[model samples]
Target chain A: DTAVSQTPKYLVTQMGNDKSIKCEQNLGHDTMYWYKQDSKKFLKIMFSYNNKELIINETVPNRFSPKSPDKAHLNLHINSLELGDSAVYFCASSQGSGRVYEQFFGPGTRLTVL
Target chain B: QQQVKQSPQSLIVQKGGISIINCAYENTAFDYFPWYQQFPGKGPALLIAIRPDVSEKKEGRFTISFNKSAKQFSLHIMDSQPGDSATYFCAASYLEDDYKLSFGAGTTVTVRA
Candidate 1:
């Protein structure tokens, strides 16, 4: 069984369009995260939820919002997507908010905004 | 600002040779350091990790060397095979920061057989 899974592995949208990416983890982890990998392959953490509570919120613009319906799912919604939003988005989960725990990642979703 | 810095954006090595990637962090608060390997179209996976207390750690052909005073860490791949070709990323996180990791720009390594 896949420990972490994402829907719509690829997303292609036009500028000003809104899109959402869904992520789910069956590892029974308490913390879930959304990360963006730019063309330079620099991975940056966007948001993190621990037990459905917002814990980490980076300097991302207001166009992007993350919602966690429960501890197992975290979804990312992008509003008025721009060309700069083109990148690979990855979902990750960990046992808890501890440094000793290793985060498990899901196959990334490639987002291309034309 | 980039909290972690990685060098040699890309590398090429022959089979059975050694591949090395280096990284440095500016935050002394970071207590955990990890190296993640990623293939095309896949998310990064944890390859090896080390803590400040330990200077070095080895797992299979992957080894992590950490320098506490310098706030630097490195990943060394021994007997690198063609299958070892992938992008490697170094990351740092503080225990008190809820495990939110700050990643370095990845290093793409190609092992020619």
Candidate 2:
């Protein structure tokens, strides 16, 4: 069984279009995260949620928003996407936040903004 | 100052040789260090980890050497095969929070047969 899974593995959209990526984890973890990996392969954390409570919000733009309906799912939504939004989006989960931080990452969703 | 720094953005090693990746951190609060291996088109998986109290930890062909005073650590892969080629990431975290790990820029290792 896949521990962490993300949907819309590949997405191609034009600028100004909005998109959403769904993520789910079966690891029985309580914390979920959203990260963006640029073309240079630099992974940066965007948002983190613990038990559906928003915890960490990095210096990301307001265009990107993360929503966690429960402990097992965290979804990413982008509003009025731009060309700079082209990159792979990853979903991750962990048992807790902060110091208990061993995260399980998903396969990643590749987004190409034209 | 929770930054984890990794060196040698890329490495090329011959099969049967040893591949090493190094990392450094500035956070003294960090107590756990873990190495993750990622293959093409796949998410990273845990490879090996070490705590500050231990100087070294070895599991199978993978070993982690840690220096508590220097706040440095490394991942050494012995008898590396082509199949072992992948992007390796080094991460550090404190036990105080729920274990939020801070990762360094990945090191891509290529083992040629």
Candidate 3:
């Protein structure tokens, strides 16, 4: 079985549009995270949720929000997206929120805003 | 600020040669360091990792050499093959938190046969 999965492998949209990317993990992990990779291939942490609590919120814009309905799902919602929002988003999960830092990542969601 | 710095943003090595990527971190609190491998259209996967306690770690063809005093670490791939070509990322985390990972920019390695 797939450990982690994300929907909408590719998305192309225009500026000012709203979009959502869904992520799910079946690893029975307690912590989930979202990362963004820009055109330069620099990966940065965007958000993290552990046991349904928002833990890490990076220096992202207000246009981006992450919602975790439960421990198993974390979804990203972008409102009024801009051209700079074009990038790849990855979802990851780990067994715990403390020592075990090895994360299992899902196939990324490539979002392009023109 | 970028807590972790990686060198050689891109690399090309002949098949069966050794490929090396280096990384440095400013945070002394970082205890765990991991290397991630990513291919096109896919998320990065954990290739190997090391802790400050060990100076060297070897697994199969991959090796990690760490210098705690220098706060630097490097990944060495022996007998590199074309199939091993991919982007490699180095990340660091503190002993206290699991919510965040400070990542290096990334290095793209191309092994030519």
Candidate 4:
């Protein structure tokens, strides 16, 4: 059984186009997160939601928005994507928003902005 | 700026050898540290974790040695097999930070048989 799942594993779109990536978790976790990994494999947290409330929003641009419909779902929508946005986006979830909890990651979505 | 720093962008170890990866952090508030393993085209999986209170933690063939005074930690893999070849990442976080992890630049370990 897949614990964490993401839709559209591979995405290729032209610059300035909008796109959305969906995520769902079967682990019954309450906290979900969005991470961006650059070509150099540097992973950084983009957004974090706990129980549908935005908890952490890093210095990411406003073009990236994350929405959590429920405890099991978190989606990322990017508006006016640019060439610099080409990278892998990963979705993760944890039982609680605590340091003790282990975050389970889903297969990443590779986005290529042409 | 990257909160966590890792060394040796890549390493190669022969079968049945030990593989070591090191990491350092400047934030003393970080209380949780974890190591993740990622294979090609796959998401990272938690391999092991450690807390600042403990100096060392060992589980099976994996071990984490932490030095709070030096603000550094290391992961050791015993008898590494070819299957162990993957990218390893070190991360640190504090509870008040809402469990937001600061990851290190990954280390790609190549285990040769």
| Model 2's TM-score against the true structure | 0.94
lDDT of 2 at A37: 83
Give the per-residue lDDT of model 4 (tens digit) for A73-110. Answer: 99999999999999999999999886579999999999
lDDT (Cα, 0-100) at A88 in candidate 2: 93
DockQ of each: 0.85, 0.60, 0.77, 0.85
Comparison by DockQ, 1 against 2, better one: 1
**Most accurate candidate by lDDT:** 4
* Model 1 per-residue lDDT at A4: 92
> What does candidate 4's lDDT look like per residue over B1-113, in tens digits?
99999987999999999999999999999999999999999889999999999999999999999999999999999999999999999999998787689999999999999
Model 4: runs farther than 4 Å from truth?
Answer: none
Q: Score each candidate by Cα lDDT.
A: 0.94, 0.89, 0.93, 0.95
lDDT per residue for candidate 3 within B1-113, as digits (tens), equals 99999998999999999999999988898998999999988899999999899999999999999999999999999999999999999999985766268889999999999
DockQ-derived CAPRI band for the predicted complex in model 1: high
lDDT of predicted model 4: 0.95
Comparing 2 and 3 by TM-score, which wins? Answer: 3
Per-residue lDDT for B7-101 in model 1, tens only? 88999999999999999988898988989999988999999998899999999999999988888899999999999999999999887887688
Tell me each candidate's RMSD, in Å, in order. Answer: 0.9, 1.6, 1.0, 0.8
Model 2, position A39, has a per-residue lDDT of: 87
Per-residue accuracy of model 2 over A1-114 as CA lDDT, tens digit each: 959999999999999999999999999999999988888777778888999999888889999989999999999999999999999998999887765457899999999999
